[model samples]
Structure formats: C-alpha cells, structure tokens
Target: MMSRPLATALRDATLLGAALLDVFVHVTSDEPLRMAVALAAASLLLLRRRLPLLTFLLTLPSVLLSDAIFASLAALYTLATITRRRTLLAVCAMAYTLSDMTRWTPSPHLDLWNPSALITLGYTAATAAAPVFLGQLVQARRDLSLRLTEISQARDHERRLSAQAVLAEERAQLAREMHDVVSHQVSLIAVRAGALQVATQDAEAKQAAATIRRLSVQTLNELRHMVNVLRGSHNRPTELTPQPSLTDLRRLIDTSGIDTELTTDLPGDLPPTLQRAVYRTIQEALTNVRKHAPGATADVRACFEGDTVRVTISNTAPTRPALPLPSAHYGLIALHQRAALLGGTVTCGPTPDGGYRLRLELPVKQEP
Candidate 1:
C-alpha cells in the first residue's frame, strides 16, 4: 500500500501535470509571455491542498490575463473539496462573472444581450460547476462512511453492556433463590434437630441430634455472609454482622440431627476468611447428609497438618429412603469456590461403603 505522503505527492503531481497539458493543448497564441504565465499557474496547483485559497487567488490572474482554463479549474476543485459548499459557490460565481466580462467573446459585433453571448456565458458556468460537483460528491461519500463506522462501534458497545447487565441480573436471581429456599429449609432442619436432641434419652441419638442443630446454625451464618456480599451497597442491617469462625464449629456440630462426631485440633488464631471457609465446608457437608441421607451417621474431623488445615466429613448410607427435595446443585459448587478463593481445595464423592465423604484442605494463613 502507498504511504499517505507518497500518495498525496502522486495526486498533486497528477493534477499539476493535467493542468499543464490542458494549457499546452488550448494555447491559441505562441507568445512567450502567455506560455510562461500558463506554466506558472500550472505549477501553483502543487500547493493547492496546503494553501487552496491562496493558490486559487494566484491562478485567477492567469485565467483573466491568459487562457489558462485548466489551471483555474484545478485550483477551484481543490478549494471546493476543502471549503464549505456555500463558499465554493460564491467564489465560483464571482470568478466566472468577471471572466465573462473581461475575456469571453461571442462575436466582434455582438453585445451581452445576444443569444451567442448568453450561450458562451452558460458554457463557462457549466465548466465551473463540473469540478465543484465532483468534489462535493466525494466529500459526501467520505462523511457517510465515517458516520457508518461510528454507528457500528456504538452498537457493539451497547451489546457488550447488555450482556453484562444480563449476567448481573442472573447472579441476583441466584442469590435470591439461595436466601429464600436453602436458608429456610436449613433453618427448619436445625430447629427440628434442636428439639429432638432436647427430647431424646439415648446417648447416640442425642449426639446425632445435637450435630444436626450445630451444622444448621453454621449454614445459616454462612448464608448470611453470602447474602451481605451480594447485597453490595444496599445498606441492609446485616452488613455489619460478624461472620462465623472456627470457634463456632463445636456449636455447629452439636445441632446436626444425625449421629455425628467432630474432632478438631485447630489453632486459636486463624485468618477470619480461612475460618469462614472451613466453617462453610463442614456446614455444606452436613447439609448434604441431611438432604440425601436423612438417618445416616456421620464423622467430622479437623486438624492442622504441617502448614495446612484439613477437615473431613463422612456419612454412612441413609438408613431410610431419602426425601424428595428440589436441588439447585449449587451448594457444593459454591463451597468449592469459597475454598479455592482462600487458596484451599475441597473434594467430595461417594465412598466405597456406599456413603459420601467431603474433604477440605486450606492453608493455615490467608494467602497474600
């Protein structure tokens, strides 16, 4: 492709060459002064783009003094392409009217009122209009193309924003579902477990009931945490509430409504975020058991091994038929994401004994 400067130089050269050729072809006299003036006028066409009005003014003398028609036409075309339409029209009208008065000749004895003189004037007007019309047409096409490009870019931007808005709305809907359905059901499970634990006499039955209630309370805390996060700047009352920590795990396990045990040897001082992740991991594991293995016995263990905290919750197969409950399939996935964000990992799957096991491993400290 031609560089801009090279292309412009080539265009100016072509216009200058055309003007000189026209002057040479139309020269009615071989006078040296007329030839020199015509050549000067043609040379001025090279500067037309940079100084179009000045070039046109310089070429006007050649048009009036000699028959350098093409030189004047080139200058007028350059001006028409660069200047406004009204300006070009006014200049063209004035220049040609002067030319007709000074240089146009119909016949030796004919006056301005003669039909031949009117024809000559009309021909000169047409000659001036031709290049101006072409310049305006080219400018109009360029403007239209630029406007189309702007409109296309604006449409693409609108589409991107619309997609973002849709994603935000979907996230808000998911938050609503978690709050309305999951939190409400988990709270009921906790309440039922608490009542059963208080009313039971068997050591194993009481232990299981306590575990259910404990886990339910933990789930409620975590749910509140997530709700606050989703609410953003809504300025709700829950925004300032404290989040759950590892210290709450014992209380959490004591509320589960199934036979469950918790053994933990965690540090007293852990990062608040990591504590929350650990609590949520255990809460979600118990919630899964409550949903899928209603009468199953479960074991939960947490310990600091080297530089990491590991928690494992395992439940035996359900002792009764599982309840039919609607599931969004998001609980464990959400738990996995929370662990990952804290630079931890979670694994949950069926065990060889036809049971479920959820394991979480997190760093002892918050990742930088």
Candidate 2:
C-alpha cells in the first residue's frame, strides 16, 4: 500500500504541474512581469495545505495579470475543506470573482449596466463558487464516514451487553431451581433423620440416624453455597462456610461408616491449603471403600518426613459382593490434580492381596 505522506506528496506535485501548465499556456515569456507573477502563483501552490489563505491571495495577482487561475482555485478549495466559516468562504469567493473579472490595467473600467458585462460578472462568480462547494462536499463526506463508524461500535457494544443479560438470567433460574427443589428435599431428609434418631430405641440405629442427620445438614450447607454462587451475588461479599481441613479429619472418619483408622503427625499450623488437600484425599479414599469395597477396612496414615508430608490410605478387598453404583470416576484424577497444585505427587494402584493403596507426598513449605 502507498503510505499517506508519499501519496499526499504525489498529489501536491500533480496539482503544481497542472498549475505550471496553465501558466505556460496563457502567460507568454515576452510579457516578463505577467509571466513572473504566474510562475510565482504556481510555485506558491506548495504552501496550500498549511497557508491556504496566503497562497490564494498571492495567486490572485496571476488571475488579474494573466489567465493562470489554477493555483488560486486549488488554494481556495483547500481553505474551504478545512474551515467551517461559511461567511469567510463567501467573502473569499467574492474577492476571487472580482480579481478574475477586473483587468490588470490601473484604469480598467466595466460598463455595469451592459448585458454582456452582467453576464460575464455572473460567469466569473459561478466559477469562483465551484471550488468552495466541492470542498464542502468532501468535508461532509468525511464527517458522515466518522459518524457511521461510531454508530457501528455502539451497536456491537449493545449486542455484548444483551448476551450478558441472557446469561445472567439463565444463572438466576438455575439458582432458583436448586434452592426451591434440591434444598427443600435435603432439608426434609435432615428433619427425618433427626426424628429417627430421637424415636429409635436401638443404640446402633440411633447412632446411624445421627450420622445421617449430620451428613444431610452438611450437604444442605454445601447446596446453599452453590446456589449463592450461581445467583451472581456480587453486590456484597459472600462469606462461604469453613472449608474442610486436617482438624475436621477425625469427625469425617467417625461419620464415614466404614471401619477406618487415621494416624497423623501433621502440624496444626500447616497452611490451610495443604491441610484441605490431605483431608479431602483421606475422605475420598474412605468413601470409595464404603461404595466399592463394602465391609472393607481402611487405614489412613499421614506424617511429616523432614521437609515433606507423606500420606497413604489403604483398603482391604470387599468382604461382600460390591454393589453397582453411579460414579463420575474422577476421584483419582481429582486427587492427582490437587496434589500437583501443592507441588506434590499422588499414586494409587491395586495391591497383590486384592486391595487398593493411594499415596500422596507434598512439600512442607510451598514455593511462591
């Protein structure tokens, strides 16, 4: 593509060449004074962009002295396109018309009432007005193009806002469904478990009912958090419930139902993220035993080895026939991802004795 400066330079050179040609055709070399003025007018065309009014005034001498008027016309057009003062443009047009019509002689006379003189005056005025009108037309075109670009940008912005509005509405609907249907069902389950715990006479049955009530309440709390998140409550800070950590491990094992043992030498002051990762890994391991290895016993071990924390969970093979259950099967994958985030590693596989063993190792001090 041609660069703007190069294009503009080429255009100015072309206009100057045309002005030179006009001077060559009308102003003869024998009339040295008139020829000099015409040449000066043509050369002054170079300053039209920056000094249009001055260039036009200098070129007027050529229009009055000789028939070379191209430089004057180009200057007037440049001034008209750049300036919005219509009165100034009209005055300049009138000046050019008078200069073009009057002869170079000091005592030049015009018979104002003569039909030919009036017609000549009108023709000169129309010629001067042509450049002004063309320049204004070009200016209007530029303004219109700019206005159209602004309008297009505004429409695109409106479309984006409308799309966001639709997405927000969908999220609100999902939140309402979870609160109205899912929460209500979980609330009923918790109430029934509480009632069962109170009414049951068998100690084992009462303990089971208590565990069920506790788990249902926890699930409800989690559901409420999810609904709030979905509802897009950004006006105020939302306080999420406390996340699980090493401190909650004992309660989790007690409520897990499967026979499990937990042994840990992890410090109480460990970073909350590390504690949560360890807690979740043990929890998932025990849950898998209860679901896929019914009647299996699980052993969870966690200890600080120098600058690293090592954790392992092992479960014996199922004593009874494993029941088919719905699973997303992402538990092991999730554990590995969690460990990786903490600059750690997780490994799990079946043992020779028909058992499963999962191990996680994490650095005690996290890298920034």
Model 2 regions lying over 4 Å from their true place: 1-6, 28-55, 192-219, 229-368
Each prediction's Cα RMSD? 7.9, 6.7
Computed on alpha carbons, the lDDT of every model, listed in order, comes to 0.81, 0.91
Show the lowest summed lDDT stretch of 10 residues, model 1.
232-241
In the range 327-347, model 2's lDDT, one tens digit per residue, is 999998999999999999999
lDDT of 1 by residue, 1-368 (tens): 88999998888888888888877886656667767777888999888889988888777767765777788888877787787767766777578546634753444243669898788777877888887887777778888999999999999999988986776677577779889998999999999999999999999899878877887897798886786666552333345457689888887776656678988988878778888888888888888898999889999999998889999999998889988998999998899899888888999899999899999998875457
TM-score of 2: 0.60
Q: Which parts of model 1 have CA positions greater than 4 angstroms off?
A: 1-9, 23-36, 85-88, 104-111, 153-172, 190-368
Best by TM-score: 2
Error of 1 at 250 (Å): 17
Collision count for each candidate, in order? 16, 0
